[model samples]
Target chain A: MKTIEIKHLWKEYGDNIVLEDLNLSVKAGEFVTLVGTSGCGKTTFLKLLLGIETVTRGKILLDDEPLVDEPDATRGIVFQRYSSFPHLNVVENVMLGEEFESSPLFGRSFGKKRQAIRERAIKILKRVGLGDAIDKYPSELSGGMQQRLAIAQALIKNPSILLLDEPFGALDPGIRADMHELILDIWKETKLTIFMITHDLKEGFHLGTRLLVFDKRRHDPDQPNRYGATITYDIPVEKTDNETLDEITGSMSNKKQEATL
Target chain B: MKRLINQHPRRIGKILLGLIPFLLILGVYSFASNERLEINPNDKLMPAFSTMADSMHRMMFEPSKRSGEYLFWTDTSSSLKRLGLGVAISAFISLVVGIFLGIIPKIRAGVAPLITAVSLIPPLAILPILFIIFGLGEVSKVMLIVLGITPFLIRDTQLRVMELPEEQIIKAQTLGANSWQVITRVVLPQILPKLIDALRLSLGSAWLFLIAAEAISSTSGLGYRIFLVRRYLSMDVILPYVVWIAILAFAADYLLRRLSRSAFPWQITATREAK
Candidate 1:
């Protein structure tokens, strides 16, 4: 069964339409990477998947049921920046999800429950290679380490679906490579269905089981925001990466010219 | 350094440079006081340091014959109590109201403009109204302080809450945090240091409101004592009281700084990054 299903999903902000006529579905544990030009509504797509943004029309279903209107434990997200809270230390950041689940009112746990969360948090931190920096704050960590902490935070709740918005776009090339390896390792270990948005097409090809290209198929010369972006290309992964990358590049350039027209 | 902006004063240089203005003010005051005292021994406008010291000693150490209370200590306590209650209440309300205003868009849209309008109103213009409503008692004095600073604090707090990155809130929610849990867990810890910062900024205004309220109506406060001694033009008592108030404000500011620093070490780097 498909874990996620989007049927003619559209999003609009007043007169400005941001996404439209989108149809996609994902089987369980699929790594789907989305790429698009700026203002083409890739972040909006992530926000929609995250349940932070509402759909203007159409519907998104999770596991054959309608996705909840608000964000819940079933879906977790990591942003490029501010994925980890600056005020919380690494372990505390990881522990907060469970605490929210345990104690909804105070967002706190006492004695045994708190201890269990702490232990689980430390274990996840070790898994993410942040054991050495458990006591350190988000501000103290490097870009890669902070992203690792963020991933750990997302992972702690053991959500079935994880949304990543260019989680490595801000990192240096060297650090980005390390994050790629780390995320891949986690994906292999867990059955997490991830929808990651990336600026880098090569990274998208390398990481995702399916690559989604979001671009506005129709545009109005008079009103730039008349129509929103649709998933113009949803390519399943091939064994060879370079050929597919070149194919996407050729189509992207052709698509850009059409968008101008 | 060639440019003032590039100049970083060494520790000793900073201390000595800081002393220059104080030393200059002291030299000017001492000269003026000594000159006036020499010319007219009964000069109440510019009392000598020794005379101020004697008055402070009598007020601080000895019980008054009529009241059987150390006037300096009594005044200090009453004034501090009022200031503390007013500021505490203001901060408590600011936090509760500001968080709700900042996090929830519906509440913010409904009430933010009203608060802005309230903040814009001159607090001193309504001082007599507060006195009339609450009467010329301790309640009026405290209410005046609360009214004077709470609006500023609430607005500051709301602004700080808005300044927090949206991703953090989303992350909290995605992790299954309820609305209140998101506030208590994510918003509260981060906003507190900023509130402490806002409080530090509001201290001068709080003291001003307290003193004005106390001077106008109260019988036992630092402001009351300072104004009461003005009939005989008691410069000695007034100068010492002024200095004492300055010392208290400085100590309070220092204590707040230390409290935020020790309790929230993460805030330093976070704020630095924000800058």
Candidate 2:
């Protein structure tokens, strides 16, 4: 069964329609990257998938089960900013994901279970390259380290789907490259279905097994509100060699140029 | 000279600089009091510092002939009890109401304006009404403090909760936290420092209301004793009482600051940046 399936989704905020007639499906382990211009409803689509926003019309199914309107542990998300809880240290932040599952009071676990969770948190932090910073607050860490902590916080829950909303947008190039490698490594290891939204076309193509472009097909200057954005291109990243990736990039750039014109 | 003072001041120099205005005030008071005393040896309007100290010692240490109770201790305990109860009640109510108003938009829209309106109603103006309904007892005084500060605290806490990043709420929910869990674990912990801050800001008004209520009706309290001695022009006793009240307020403020600093170190950085 497909990990996620959306049918004829429409999200309208009064007259300002953000998304319309959107349909998508993803296999269990596909790393899908969504790329679009700013305000193209890319983030909104990801929010819908995470159940952060309600669909105006149509249905979303997770593992063939109808998804509810509230966010759940079945899906995990990393926002571009404010993802990590500043008040919690790195280990506590990572432990929070697991903590919420067993104990709702937050960090109230005790005895062997608590020790085991702590060990698990420490292990996950080490995996995310944050072992040395386990006791440090998020504010004390650099931007790249904070983002890594956020990923660890999300991934500790072991959600079947991981959603990323421009999670590397704030990082410097070197850090961004390192983050891309880390994300790829984690995706390969966990085989969790990943949906990431980004404005960086190269980064999107580099990290995704499939790339989707969201854009409005029609523009009525007098009534721009009449149309909403939808997925325009869905390309499978043929990862056999560099030439295939380059050819896909070349065609995508052509499409982007034509759309801009 | 300015640069030297700014950059290379010793600790003693900084202490002396802080004391300048206080020393100046004391000098002026002493000069005026001496002139009055020299003119009229029985003048009671401006008592000397030693006279005030003597009165403080008597009130604080000696037991009353009739009740055998130290009036100073009684008044201090009574005032503290009322103040503590009032602030605690207000903080609890504000937390509960503020979280609801902040999380549920519908409730916020419906009740926020009402809260604003209620907050605008001068708490002092209804002092007589509170006395009439609750009686001129500890209840009325505590209610006055609650009435004076709860609205402001609620508004402050609600604003803080609302100002929290939407991403945090969403992130909390995505981590399998239900609505109650989100409010308790995510919202409450984050807003606790803000609540302390709001309480600190409202302390001035809380003291004002408590004094007003106590002065009007209480048989025993700092304000009651001060007002009672005012008719005789007992400047010595009145001044000490006022100083005692100041000390209490300062102590409360300092303790709350310490609490927030230790309990929520993350919040301290945000507040420092804001400053």
Candidate 3:
């Protein structure tokens, strides 16, 4: 079964329809990247996958089962800004997801469970090259380091599908490149299914095995909320240079127009 | 030594020299006034000074009585101890409540009016009702102190939580943090400095509530001591308690400032540069 499947999904906020009749499927361990201009509903799709936003119509399935109301360890998410807990050091932030792994009901603190969670967290931090920073507070680290910590936090549980909503969008080009490579390496090593939303077209092609391009029609200058925006194309990212990738994207857009007509 | 001297050579030298005589003059003036200003034996001024002298003497000479002894007039030391306990407990409680309420928008929105109403109720108004329920015991006093102080903590913390750099929240969430993880890890840390500040502000309220506590019920607190002295037209004893309250409040505030500095070193640098 596909790791994630979306069928006729639609999302709306107030009178605005964000995603209308969206259908897509991500195969097991496939790297799926979503790229679009601002307010193209890439973020909304990621949020929907994470179960943060509700669908107006249709359904999202994880491993052929419908995604539940609350997010579990089966699906992990990473946001654009580094949301490493300032109060908690890197280790604690990473271990936070472990609580969800054991049970949905909170407040079961066991020694074995705690140790297991800690080990998993440390392992993830090491994988992300943040083992040394496990004890450091988020404020003590640089932006890149904090983002890495955030990645570790999402990676700790080894979820079947990882949802990233512009995790490297805020970093400088150099750091962003490094993060992109790190994520690519991690995805290769773990073979984890990924659904990353990004605005950078180059980054999207490099990272995503399949790229989902959102439509210009979905964006409104007056009311711009990406979580409630319509998405359009679900294009496979062919291994090619920047010029070739753009041509592919253009072809995909034309196909969408034909389908709509 | 040479490097240090060069860094602040002329400024330090001038300031040190200038302060010597100014300090001496101030001390001499204070001592001279104490000796020369003779009020009528029956006048309120003489008794006030006597009370001040007694408190100073007790603080200097009687260390054990500060904690061990309990008397109607002897409350400065006890008041100091109780105030310390109140602050510690209130701070702990405030941190727990502040973080919980601050993170949950629904809870904050739901309880906003109730918290506001409770906060607006004067500490004095609650004293009688608290006394009736809890009696003239430590329970009522401590309860009043918490009620007086926690609302400010909640409001201040909620504001801090709201003001948290949106960048951090968006970043963490993108990283796959659930709501609890975000609250404890990101939001709580950033909001801590402001919360500590709120707690420090609440300290002054704690002392005020403590006095109110003594005033309404207790036979042996600084407030009660002052009330007792006022009855006898003994302004001297009353003055000491007043001075004692000021000193205690100052000391509490100063200690909290130091604590805040150690806990939030960033804020210390922030304030030092601002000054």
Candidate 4:
């Protein structure tokens, strides 16, 4: 069964079309990674899925039900920057989802329910390797630690789908590797349907069960913005070995390769 | 030692450097007062420090002979009450209005121009209008303060809200926060420190309106006392009142700074790193 399905989706801003006639179906518990060059509509696709940007045409279905125009608890997102509230500490940040769920008006819960929420938040933080830094603020944490807190914040609500937009883009290589392992472990444990966008082809190939490449196949010299980018390459990596992946990459690049990526 | 001083001045040296300007002003004032006294022993202008001190003691400690009320304390309490009421009301109103204007594009488009136009009007020019409408009472004075500062506060808060990263708002919503919940939980907490900063900046203008309104008409206030003593050339009372006003303003600013540091420690850390 598909967890998310997009049919004939089109996104445009004024005369500029960013995504055109795109269709995607993501099954439950699939780790999907998208790779593209800058301004190739990769981030726009994520925004459309997160409901931050509305589609110009067509519909998106979540668990066979039409998704609403606004964001909901079923979908969680982590951005490259500003992934966590700087004012809240690690524990408070992780607990924020449950707090909002319990008391939508006050953004807080009280009594025994609040204690349970805190304990859950702490357990999640521990899983994310942030138990010692629960009392620290985002500004006090290193870049890697902050990303971990953000992941905990997103995962605490047990969202069915997690969207990450270049979440490890700012971390060092060592930290990025650690984050990759952490994210993979989480995906394995929770069986979440995750959609991640990355500029690094190796990272995209290494993590995801399915890989999607976005690029504008048809280009006109006179009217550059006439057509939007579509998914030019969709490679299933779950069953393909490293040698087979190279053979697939060679054939895919020959079919519709763009100069940028 | 010289190299060390050039690289970074010691704490004691920095303190002495800061005090130099104050000491210079004091010395120049004392010299001017002595010169004036030599010409006229009964001179009311630039009264001696001792003379000013005596007047302060009388106004602050002793009750009025006719009314049996400590004028200084009564004036302070009344002025503080008006100032506090005006600031608190305007802050609450501006917060609600500013957030709405910032988050909702339609409301922002409709009301932003009106607020900008109102803010452009010099608050002092409306002093007579406020007095005539609200009458020569505490209401008028407090209203004047609110009118003077609310627009600026609203604009500041709106800008702060707009400057927030779009990702944060989206993240909040995806985390199951409805519109109101996103505002209260995410937007409100982020902008509170900024609001305190806006209030701190508005206090200067708030004091200006308060004194101007009080000078026009008021039964009891620090501004009223200052203007009352001005006609008699009571330099002793006037100078002391000016110094007292300065002290009060400093205390208020200090208290606000301390409050922001304690209430929002994360903001402080962020600012420190930014610096």
Candidate 2 lDDT: 0.87
In model 1, the Cα lDDT at residue B75 comes to 98
Docking class of 4: medium
Fraction of native contacts, model 4:
0.85
Best model per DockQ: 1
Q: Give the C-alpha miss distance for residue B103 in model 3, angstroms.
A: 4.5
The alpha-carbon RMSD over the true interface for every model, in angstroms, is 0.9, 1.9, 5.3, 1.0
Alpha-carbon runs more than 4 Å astray in model 4? A238-261, B1-6
Residues A77-166, model 3: lDDT tens digits: 676653555555668777766654454344223689888888888988898999888777666777788778877876766677887878
Q: For all candidates, state DockQ relative to the true structure.
A: 0.82, 0.54, 0.20, 0.76
- Deviation (Å) of B5 in candidate 2: 12
lDDT of 4 by residue, B1-275 (tens): 46765787579999999999999999999999999999999999988999998998999899999799999999999999999999998899899989888887899999999999999999999989988998998899999999999999999999999998888888888788888888888888888889888999999999999998999899889999999889999999988888888899888889988998898889977777668
Q: Root-mean-square deviation of each candidate, in angstroms?
A: 2.1, 3.2, 6.5, 2.8
- Give per-model TM-scores: 0.95, 0.91, 0.75, 0.93
Task: Decide which is better by lDDT, 1 or 4.
Answer: 1
Candidate 3 error regions (>4 Å): A99-121, A218-229, A239-261, B1-55, B58-73, B81-100, B103-112, B136-139, B157-196, B231-240, B254-275
lDDT of model number 1: 0.90
Residue A44 C-alpha lDDT in model 3: 76
